[model samples]
Target: MESIGTSQIKKAIHHISESVFVGLCRKVGTSQMVAMKRDVVDILEMVEYYVKTSDYYIVMLSGSCREGFRLKESDIDSMFWPNNYRVIWDLSQSHYYNTQRQTLILCDCSDSPPGFTLLYLLSPSINRGILEACIRMKNSCYISSSKYRQKICSLSSSNETEHGPCVSGAYGTLEYDNAHCLSCDFWPPSASSWIERCHSWPQPHIVDDIVNNGCHFVAIGHKLGRHEDHEWRISFSLAEQKLVYAMNHCQFLTYCLLKLFLTEIINNGLDEDDKLLCSYHMKTVVFWVIQQNTLPHWRPLNLLGCFWVCFKLVLKWVYEGVCPNFFIPDNNMFLSKIHGYKQRQLFMRLYGLYEKGLAFLLQIPSIRSYIINVLHNPKVSICTDEHTLISEAEFDETLYNEIHCFDVLYKSDIQTCMRYLHTIEQMIGSPLLTQYQVIMLQILTASLLKDTALILRMETFTCKNKLKYRADKISCHMLKVAAKFGFITDMLFIAMYYFETRRYRDALSITEMIKGKLAQPYLMYESKVDTKMYTEAVGGQSWCTKMRKAVAWDIRLYSGIHYISELVSEQQSALRKKKTILYIPSFILLYMLEVLCYRHVDTMRVQTALDDLQTLVHYDQGQLIDLRHRDISWQILGICQQLTGNHQTALY
Candidate 1:
């Protein structure tokens, strides 16, 4: 019998993995999903009616439900915003308050201003009023306010209200038709600051988009006994919803696999009281993992790989007893649950399953047979088809359109940032510009500058000469600004810009500087999860480490460096030999850069690129990289091979 080739083995693994994911999705069942959606709509309608009749203005459905990754048992999480009152931050006192309450009560303390009040007023009377109003609603539902309050009190030993055991805010359950239920929390509009606080996140543009729209902040009770702090908990549910919505078919299916793993396997055998993990936690892990990876890393065939990445993240969190909130790092979502002995138990259970690999995943009750069939009999047809896979032409077209949009968006954002900077310069001495605002302006400006440099590098080979020259000048200035702001990723682009412009010495110098910086330990200055910040401080370091492993791994960076080094060596040899060197035109230099990039486009090179990308995809378990750039790398390699008469290999 002939032995199977390596590529065939990979293809087989890919097919089997996809089949398993499809089976899991099938087990999830469309009927249950339909039921969940109908129930959610009905609940939302009811809430909308209540808000319309009452002082509340709107009801926002949030959490897993809004994120489109909900399970059958997942509770509907929502926020109610009042219409008559405007929530405002009281600078005089370090708490939030409603503007209307200022005139209702008077305080004469020296430190406290007379026209200030606590926001929401979580007193016994207020709690009772809200609870009574819910009970009076026409919907015949079971009220679990008492049980929720008791649970909150048990979680925290803070002062309780006279009406009942109270936490930081009120909690009530509205059961509908004995088949569905919604858990609602009321919060003041001022709590939106929690979302605003994520402005310092690495992806400033995405955070800006979230802020520009609206972010919800919920009133979650204190985990510990810290009562003086009534800070509202920020929820990125809206941003998450948008992110999940933008996911391609493959990513959505991968998410389903994760939910199934959490619900059917992890939570299945455990007693109700012993279950610490939930679908929400799994979703949070997925969000962080997605932020760290690129699109190619999340292909449909790699669904199991993505699931494993999320699992490892959760396992690490369990071991550390700390699952940092995706948006707010300071808020440890797992602080209360995975403590002491429980952490050890949780870690062991997950680790054991992880060691068992596909066999363990097959143990999931609902899809056990489907997974077994896919694994044992490779010939079996897996229901999950490759419909999500895009043709080469489609992929190229999509890439072109996306890059075009990115070019326009980055240019527009850069102009806006400059205008803001100019405005700040005009207001330099004015009291209106606070320290925080100044810092924010600097951050936003730095981020936009980095983006500008990145966009310029991406377009260097494609754009016209005049535009390329303009991009070069702007990129140099932007790189200096980014350096001043201590953004290292922008510096990496600076090196690439120098290379593209034929400044080999300068490019090499910048690369060396980046390497030195990458050697140092990274520290988190702010308690927010920003992708750019993480990439610059930590992710960049990891990338450098990976690049140093093999020149073939990051062909774009390392190969360019190698070519520059060789060019410099040849020039020095000519000087030593006393030979007159002919000057090359700028266009010739650019052509040389392109040739060097595509010169080694053999079958081995193409395979090496794919293997390197796959290795990088698996490295760090679930961290995200710029996969779009990786995609471009493959395209360049293919085009180079095609030009050099390796048309068949290039087509492959």
Candidate 2:
């Protein structure tokens, strides 16, 4: 450590000392939670040491007061980064073993390449060993927290509780600037350099061992009024950010894996002794292998996760050869109990993707090449009909998550095929692979997208143009392999493409192709055994006959309007909310009134509909009530008048 009195490191340490933090806040008279601990460096040093020593590098230090009520008997809140570099200064060699309480690893990631960071609070371990394991686990990956945010934008006002920004690690130190700052209200740096200064923070020089681990941050927004803000105003939502952050992290890992893997293939490479970085890495390389021909941005992160998760389940089952009992709720994906050959294929693909993602993470290029080369392996042939060859449950989820299946398959899997081709091209230093690889890549561009006009220009050149090698069709295996993913939209696109080219018969033939499989026992049902029925009516219309049709219609029109799929995305959300507003007797009244009109039964239904309308009118607010209720009531009156035909009408 640097001398306690001289260096900037000493200044940071001095700043965090209880006397420093509390004294600073007290002198400024800002009301932060009373201090629970201070000096904070012991724990910081410990965390930093482990971070630097372990494969994960990049350690950050930000001080806290109460530790957010999460302090154990002398708990030190510090974030650690452990992607893969060993930090020389890290002191956390066996620190995880000492923790006695259950640990909670709060994650904030929602999705991943500029991966989103999550706030996951790992479940507390009942005992210390479990806690140790938890810490060890946290140590195994990159770590972070919102506390790192600046403590004050500018600690100007004693109105700390009022307009003052709360203290985060960097909270007070890194405001907009002096003039713009709350305290000085002036641009600290020049006005032009304000943004630049904020972005150009100095990376800490944590000993020679630590590598920089990127951070996942919350995008803070200022709300107008102090009291009039949403719950999320104080902090980012935990659950909301998981998927995206996880995805982005996956992408980053994929980029690194490809770099590492190809580097190995080019430079003699890894021996068998290297420890696997788990399935996450391999899944990425598998994705790279699939997407080798495409740009990095084209790869899908979640599908890779899906494949990895699927693989984990299968690996668990095959090792024991016993029936596995697990349910992938998103898809009724079961491992031990696949009912058919197709299902086995589905499991294999997901498992395969999982394996590849792991390979990518661990820097296993040989594994990547091995997996990629197997695309042409005679024994492990590509499935011709995905539903008939892979589990529909697994296929549907992987295929339909966000990107189109064909686009995803090409982007995720097929590109790996071309990556192999390109890899061969790179090794031989021959230009022959270029033309074939380029044409194969065009398969990614729908033959119909206008952009393909450029791709079409280079279509004439073949592997044969270079002499020795004959560039043939992208093997029947490749097409059949992709066809099994069972993507209806892809079929639609292909059919539309043919029709666009004036090949009506071919277009029609393609439509007839997947139509039969669309209705097959979508193996997904077995996966989602606990799936609940969605509310059929908008906003849970159990008996809201006279309820707010506005909310209902708003939901119905807006919920599924954009999702092109037949299975509406909001159908589950709307059903799950099962929102019960007031008892909407209007629907019942309307039904009764309709029956009365149909069978000429002059029942009490019309009057009830009228009463329900009046109740709605009474409860609703001024203008909004008038706007919402007026039309429905007027329509009811119109219907009643029509029911009467020429009968005398009375004013309400």
Candidate 3:
């Protein structure tokens, strides 16, 4: 990260231009390469003028040049190469090496990162001498026309082209005896297809594209369609220089992967599929947009919140006694009997929904903190035994009515049910969960006593946590009750199940789904039964270290949402002045619900555990003076390292 000297920057520019010159002129050979000398002179003149006016210093690297290795030009470039400095120097002198001695390689870490590390990110290497990456800077390589000439010159007349066959100069066909040698062998949508697909989307002038889209210049010839001798062909291969030159100097063909989300719907304007897809896209953008440094049209919370609203409106029809989308049946599914692919699809969709909703909440850390903090609030200990939650007459009457109505109503009506349940507390001084919720709980408890999953699971635990473990024990039973003919009942739980299995890639895809979040995704992906089954009672993903604090805030906020309903309930019920304001108990019930969620999610969530780690990191507010919480941005680097099997580095 150190600032490089103006002179070294100029020399680096000159070196690349020289490589390009040498790469381009086969007949003009090393003699014609002086063409780039003009570029060097121009760059030096500019740097000389700029140097005195600017503050800059040379950055160095500390490392040994890997032994007996070569480098590819398309890799990212740096001013110095500690790993392969001599090879770098050979190129700097255009391979006419002379008058250079080996110097100790080191960098002022305070001012700059070592140069070899920079090149390694930028360069392409293969052998241990100079370990080049296999996948990094993929779009930086290009097979040039000059190289084509050299290769063709080496080929005999027996074959029309050295690449196996030349359909024309612009198009040479490689006849690989072993197709596996091709980087993209038999995939349905080949690499070239992705490039063409991207190009097919609207393209603007190069400068405009970079100015508007988030492209920081791209390597020339990498992924570009070419014409030579009036023939069009694909060039493939890149080196470190290509990465450096393209990144430093702007280019027309830089790739913009974020542009992949440009989507629109037609044919009937926002049909169910369109509605869902739009929501999906919004969620994906929410995930990526914040991670990037760009001109954001809408921040993550605004965007995610908007999507949540849209999804509610779109799916609200189902709450009114109809199942709009069977894919996310209230039970959802996982380890399901249904087709594996369908299960995966449904789970991913649900994950997306929850992620959008949860991410929106996460982005508003105050709100998330508020919601979570209430869980730690103390219960009313001073109340006398005479002051019960609600009169039994009203509790019994509401319980009777609700049970009868719930038998016929869809379970997703839980929100409306929740509102109604909250209403009782507002009217009469009663707690929802403690009274009627207890009634419902009793019914579920009796039904569960007869189920076998509970019987077997109970055997796995000691008798002590049994009642406390009911939430963990009977989700499958409740799900069975919730299920129709033969489908699983919860999308979120399926996501959780998948997560427990270390299927996070699929879980990631599912979190992008909204249908999974609200509907029964395995006991709310936060139920005690779910959390305990998943073992979230520990300070895992579920129990935010500040859980006690966040829960307190949640109850206060959630209670405020239902305050008007509660006040009207109290006024209608004609409760006494001392007992009229019953908002606090309702807040307490909500607090318990969130704690359940925290516990359940802790037990079951995965990718999000790392996500929580990130929040915890930023939560430090720099108080620790240690870089323990490396920030959420570490997710990408960690994942990338894990993918490359760099477990130690990934852990670090």
Tens-place lDDT per residue, model 2, 1-652, is 4464456533332222222222222221112111111112222233234324432233333321112111111122222222321111123322432333323333322232111222232344343222232212234422222121222233333322212123222222222111111001111111222123222111123211111221222322222222111101111111111111223322333333333333343123344223222222333333323222233332222323333443354455434333311111111112213345644554464456456544442334323333344334424332222124323222222212211211211111233334433432343343533332232223233311211221221242342444311221232223233333222223343443343334545544564454443333321211221112212222232111111111111111123121112113323443344421111122322232332332233345445534554454446443223343344344444444444442454234
* Model 1, span 187-289: residue lDDT tens: 2233344455543232666655655554433333334523213223334566666565555556666677777778888888688679889766877787677
Which residue pairs in candidate 1 collide? 201-530, 202-530, 202-531, 202-532, 292-623, 292-624, 293-624
Runs in model 2 lying further than 4 Å from the true structure: 1-211, 214-489, 521-652
Q: What value of lDDT does candidate 2 attain over all alpha carbons?
A: 0.28
Clashes of each: 7, 99, 65
Best by lDDT: 1
Residue 583 lDDT in model 2? 17
Q: Candidate 3, which segments miss by more than 4 Å at Cα?
A: 1-207, 210-303, 307-367, 370-652
Worst lDDT 10-window in candidate 2? 177-186
Error of 2 at 473 (Å): 9.3
Stretch of 10 with least lDDT, candidate 1:
175-184
Tell me the deviation in Å of residue 386 in model 3: 52
The TM-scores of all predictions, comma-separated, are 0.42, 0.20, 0.16
* Candidate ordering by lDDT (highest first): 1, 2, 3
Cα RMSD (Å) between model 2 and the true structure? 29.6
Q: Which ten residues in a row have the lowest lDDT in candidate 3?
A: 61-70
Relative to the unseen true structure, what is the Cα RMSD of model 1?
23.8
